[model samples]
Target: MMDGASQFATTMLLRPWWLLALLALALLSYLALRRVRGLGAWEQAFDPALLAAMERFGHVVPGAARRIFWPVAVAAIAILALSGPARRIADPDTFRNLDGIVLAIDLSRSIAEGGSLDDAQAAAQMILQLSAGRPVAMIVYAGEAYVASAFTLDALALSPVLAVLDGEIVPNAGSRSDRALDLAATLFSEAGILSGDVVLVTDGDHLTPQAFDAAAQLAAANIRVNGFLVEPTARHGDMPAPDRDGLERLTRLGDGSLGNAADPAPLADTIGKRAASALAKGETAALFFRDYGRYLLVLALFPALALFRRAT
Candidate 1:
């Protein structure tokens, strides 16, 4: 429950500076009425006999309410209308475009052994940073897939969750892009949201034929799968051979492009642009406020109309 003054405050001008001008209008109207009535404009305009002839013999004489009262009332109502009275109101018809992005990380031993897991993690963080203010989810996959973080707009909140992804989390020893893609699709289905992109961060050492099928399905649903191939930055190393063809094929099937983790800035820019474009295609409803000035104008009409009526 609000105190009387607090309740009154919200019912009036949101920007109270306008009220000063409204008060001035009211004061000017009062002063003008006093000056005009003191000069007796009606009396000056007509003779006493003419005024007596205009009044009906059997009818009641016009009182202050029928004369000064209605004009004052009209002026007061007009002043109130101009004062810009407003309150916080909900308008549920507002809309905006928003999209979600899912990051699928391969946690197989190959990524751990090749020492490119950090590369994948770094790529994911970079994507997260580039795609700020967008809903992001994380999935870690080895032989099976696990949701490291649910879909959310707060990318920072999911950073810790992404930091813990490793081969140990999955307990299995194999990598299956099929499993990861399938689970990511299921997450999208459950969330009932349109995603701008699905980012696959992996060495692609264990990509199966089924991964292509999954990518096709995702593409059919308008969810593009972008791939990040985490490669060794050095010229010669014992790093496991990344399945370049597999990443290329998966991205092709998913209507997406493959990116190198070594240089993620371009990839981030590409994904960011595409995601923003995709997100712009859809809109979501939200609550807002509508001004009541027109309603006040309608309300002011009642007192204004009364000014033209004769007293009975």
Candidate 2:
């Protein structure tokens, strides 16, 4: 049953959108242009020739002497990138070339019902595909969670672990994601898993307050959490997992909670993109585009007039 607490529609995340910081960066870039010895030197060397040439263009006749900023601007922007443009994209995607990752799957009773099996199958496929030869550790939790598969990027070797998931596995343990997440965190903390990534797949149903607490704790660690929700409808063999109130709270905490009403297909695809993007952006684009996109443009519009006459 949906509880009033879960119904409270407050946004859960803290977003520090850097609008002001970006404006400042743009302002600074413009100032840097003012001090550029290269542009000034180039202007001193070619300004006379450029001005004389612009005077020939009928249109330049009106302001021929004043239009000498275009080529210098292009050169400046390219120079900026050469100096450090890739650094600006700030947050770009990254390849998982470093270490093996963990894929913790939910195998509680609910996973077998309500079209959840299909979702489970799809999630498994995505994990294996995305793992890309990185070692993956699998865990299944219903009421109780256990390591079904150890860390191995080889998905083929992990099949035994994934296939063991079923509703009957948990018995009377009761649904508790906290335990599952706790296990994952602990697993990753092991010396071997300390440096790799972590992927968690589950239906955000039957979450207890403890789950959210556990999720909050796990997030504080360096592990990356990605959720794949399996469907909850009755058909397809899903059973009575707990109600929704607590699960909603858990979702708010994990942020990694990815989903579509128990459908893993979309969750897998979306989380894959987000994880890949977040990783890449952090390494390359995040620092740049997150704040410098507009600042870089200031130099462009201000000095573009110089090159326009020449190109024409």
RMSD of each: 11.3, 14.5
lDDT of 2 at 296: 61
Per-model TM-score on C-alpha atoms: 0.57, 0.51
lDDT of 1 at 15: 38
lDDT of 2 at 183: 83
Question: Cα lDDT for residue 297, model 1?
Answer: 76
lDDT of 2 by residue, 1-312 (tens): 355454333212112343344455556556555645234454566677785676577433332322334554555554443333322222222333334456666666666655566667567766676554455677777778787766664667776656666677656555567778788777776734323445556666666667677777765654545555556556443356534444445545655555543455565554444343343324433422334334566667656654545544
Best candidate, lDDT: 1
Candidate 1 local lDDT, 149-175, one digit each (tens): 888777778778768776688887778
Worst 10 residues of 1 by lDDT: 88-97
Model 2: lDDT to the true structure: 0.55
Give the Å error, residue 81, model 2: 14
- lDDT of model 2, residue 139: 72
Candidate 1 lDDT (Cα, 0 to 1): 0.72
